[model samples]
Target: MPGHELRYDVNCSILFTELPLLERPAAARAAGFDAVEFWWPFAEAVPPASQVEAFLAALSDADVQLVGLNFFAGDMPGGDRGVVSWPTRSAEFRENVELVAMIGAATGCRSFNALYGNRIPDIHPGTQEETAVANLAFAASAVARIGGTVLVEAVSGPQPYPLRTATDAVAVLDQLLVERDIRNLAFLADLYHLTVNGDDVPKVLTEYADRIGHVQIADAPGRHQPGTGEIDLDGQLGQLERAGYRGWVGLEYLPSGPSAESFDWLPRHRRGGGADQTNEGDG
Candidate 1:
């Protein structure tokens, strides 16, 4: 009930895995959501134009607004870490910039999450960090032209990701903003990943409220629906509101049962895009 005051968008990439990528938007619309976000829609960094058009068409047909998207993280299910920061992958990342920016411009998407690449053996941290900063500046500039912000998040995993804390992420944003003069980069506060890394959730919520560009949530331990884990999400959502964040709150959780069952924690009226919930529910 606490987060009901905030706008919510389901992350179709993880939430509706039971449906095909092209079918997920309609599935979400059926389940009462008209705003959705996704990881890059294809395994390839630059999916073919037809595939991209089909995706956009699906969004239009389902009548959902695209709220957020990830820059390709490489084969996520096959264990490939992200590539934006990798020395060898810099060229690959460069190729996808305009493609992603085009999607943002078309869909009015404002938030882009650029995952930091995994560390490779014997590769200097300075080298990777420099590449990442430059790459982020490029993305920031592209989206900024459209009045959008590029987001950096601290992913909880092995030693691959150097950004293991909010401080780490903010530091990257500050450095890039200062050096590149790009003002649109911001932190993506993903509560589930931060909690997995042992961050003090309350402190993160209060201290970083003004600096966050977007927020995503899942219950920790198993990364399932809100009430399924030890995370005090209701309390955190209330705190998020009190801290003065009025941005969209993304439901990035994986469902333990059916994705439709996941919303039992949220009231039916608040689940879909605000106005459409009524007709969607009735339909």
Candidate 2:
């Protein structure tokens, strides 16, 4: 089978944690990556202007593109998947949307990942779904000004996240399209999460390729670099490529050792896409 070369980017939020938040971009650049993605960087929904400036300046200094970003998911370190469905935090999520749009405008980053909040016990599932739909629509509309696409991802792990499968996430996207006619919403195909959740990986790539706005990968069993786990990351990515999905593939894995040394499985030359396509299958 013919192999398709995909563009790669580092998820600085996870890959370069050895350095301070503002310094990770340069670290990624030093490691031979031209593009990077990140989760919400600030503790609050809206950070101070100085902090925002510093964050942008770091990216500028390093000359790395911010290819992907997450909206304020509300205490991610504290195990909050997202607050899109949390009725009390609706206002906070909206504030984060504006900030996200501003960052997108400045960085030329058009892909935004919006994690659906976990289910609330006291809240009716219907009500939470309604809240999620409204918030997602609002986010999609805000980012649309910058020619952006809002991404909905199927997250794995122990959280009661409502969308645990590609079908589940797409159902929400379909709802958005039918109810609000929102065309800017798309699915974020995180291969590790989908696999961990027991969804048929090839089936999803075949069925939802056209709807995928972004792709993220980490080896399963443990979210580490590609070759360390049993997943055939290369083959699955090839399937995605053949299905006509041409988008950035984010390296969102934890390093088995030091962050810089974890990329041995992927050659430096193939880190950024261009005429150099050698050693494509080493991963």
Which tens-of-lDDT digit does each residue in 1-283 have in candidate 1?
6965577888999988988989988888887877889998897999889999999999999999888889988878766657878888887887887888999889878788898877777899999999899899888888778777888899886646788889888899889878877778888899999899999889987888878878889997899988899999888889987877667778998899998888888877787655233111100
lDDT of 1 at 178: 85
TM-score of each: 0.94, 0.95
Taken over the whole model, the C-alpha lDDT of each candidate is 0.83, 0.87
- Runs with alpha carbons beyond 4 Å of true place in candidate 1: 274-283
The ten-residue window of minimal lDDT in model 1 covers: 274-283
**Candidate 2 wrong stretches, greater than 4 Å:** 1-4, 273-283
Our tally of clashes for model 2 stands at 0
> Given candidate 2, what's the lDDT at residue 90?
96
The per-residue C-alpha lDDT of model 2 at residue 13 equals 89
- Point out the worst 10-residue segment of candidate 2 by lDDT: 274-283
Per-residue CA lDDT of candidate 2, range 1-283, in tens?
1234577889998988988999999998888888889999889999899999999999999888888899999888888999998889999999999999999999878888898999989999999999999999999999989888999999999989989999999999999999999999889999999999999998998898888888899998899999889888888989988876667889999999999999887788777652132212111
